[model samples]
Target: MYKLKTKETDNSVIEFIESVDSPKKREDAYQLLDIFTETTGYKAKMWGPSIIGFGAYHYKYDSGHEGDAPLVGFSPRKAKISLYFATGDTERENLLKDFGKHTTGKACVYINKVADIHTDVLQALINQSIRFLKETYPNH
Candidate 1:
C-alpha cells in the first residue's frame, strides 16, 4: 500500500507557524494563513507537518488510487514557499502569467515570499483551484 505522507492530522496550524526558524518565513506563513482562509472561506488545518490547508475534497483516480486532499494549501519551506493549487486548469496557468516572481510545478507554485507575488492573482488562483476540484470530484 502507498501511504500518503501528507495526510491530514490534528496538529495546530498556529503552533506550526510559530515554530518556523526563519523570521521572514514565519511572517509569510501568517500572511498565507490569512489569505488562504479569506479566499477559500474555510479555517486552516494542518496537513502533514508543514502544509496549512483549507477546504478538502476526496478523489479517486483511474488507477484505483483514492485519497482526500485540500482544495488549496501551502507550506513555508526553507528554500521557497510551496503553494498547492489545482492541476490541469487552464485558468490557473493564465493567471500565473502575471502572478509575479513565482515558479510552478505539476501542481505546486513556488514563491520566495508573500510580497513577491500579487495577492489578488493568488486569490484568483485559490478560487479557480477550488472550483476545478469541486467540479472534478463532485461527490466530494
Candidate 2:
C-alpha cells in the first residue's frame, strides 16, 4: 500500500515557527499564522514536520490511495513560504492576478514573504480552496 507523508501531528505550530532560523521568516510565519487562521476560521495544526495547516479533509483516489490533509496551509521555508490550496480551482488562478509577487505550482503558491503578497488576495485564495475541497469531498 502507498502511504501519504503529510499526515497531521500534535506538534505545536508555535514551536515549529520558532524553529525557523531567520527572525524575519519567523515574523512572517506569525503573520501568516494570524492570516490563515482568520481566513479559514479554523485553528492552526502541524501537518507533517513543516506545514502549518488549518482545516482538514479526507480524500480518496480511484487507484485506492487515500489520506487526510489540510484544507489550507502554509510553510515558512528557507527558500520561500509555500501556500497550499486546492489545485484545480480556476477562481484561485484568477485571484492570483492581483496577489502580488508570487510563483505557483500545482497546489502550492510560493512567496518570499507575507508582505510580498496582498493579504486580501491570499485570504480569497484560501477561501476558494476551502470551499472547493468541501464541495468536492463533503464526506471528510
Candidate 3:
C-alpha cells in the first residue's frame, strides 16, 4: 500500500509560518492564512511540515488508494508560494486566466508574492476547490 506523506498533523501553523526564512515570505504566509481562513471559514491546520491547509476530505481512487487531503492549501517555499487547489476542475483553469502572475503545475499554483495575484481570484479558487471536493467525495 502507498502511504501519503502529507497527512495532517497537530503541528502549529503559526509556528511554521514564523520559521520561514524570508521575512517577505513570512508576511505573505500570514496574509494567506487570513485569506484562506476567511474564505473557507475553517481554521488552518498543518499538513506535513510545510503546508498550511484549510478544510479536508477523504478520497478513494478506482485503484483502491485512499487518503485524506486538504480542500485547499499553500506552502511558502524557497522560490515561490505554492497554492494547492482541486486538480481536475475546469473552472479552476478559467479562473486562473484572470488570476494575475502565477504558474501552475498539476496541483499547485506558484506565485512570487501575494501582491502579485488577485486575492478575489484566490478566494474563488479556494471556494471552488472546497465545493469540488465535497461533490466528488460526498461521504467525506
Lowest lDDT 10-residue stretch of candidate 3: 100-109
Pick by lDDT: 2 or 3, better one: 3
Error of model 1, residue 28, in angstroms: 0.9
Per-residue CA lDDT of model 2 for 48-123, tens digit only, reads: 9999999999998898888999999999999999989998778988999999999987769999988788998988
**lDDT: the better of candidates 1 and 3:** 3
Q: What would you estimate as the lDDT of candidate 1?
A: 0.93
* Candidate with maximal TM-score: 3
Badly placed stretches (over 4 Å) of model 3 are none
Q: Please give the ranking of all candidate structures by lDDT, highest first, separated by commas.
A: 3, 1, 2
Quote model 1's TM-score. Answer: 0.98
lDDT of each: 0.93, 0.93, 0.95
In model 3, what is the error at residue 115, expressed in angstroms? 0.6
Write model 3 residue lDDT over 15-126, tens digit each, in one string. Answer: 9999999999999999999999999999999999999999889999999999999999999999999999998989999999999999988779999999999999999999
Each prediction's TM-score versus the true structure: 0.98, 0.97, 0.98
Q: Which residues of candidate 2, in runs, are more than 4 Å off?
A: none
Q: For all candidates, what are the clash counts?
A: 0, 0, 0
Residue 31 local lDDT, model 1: 93
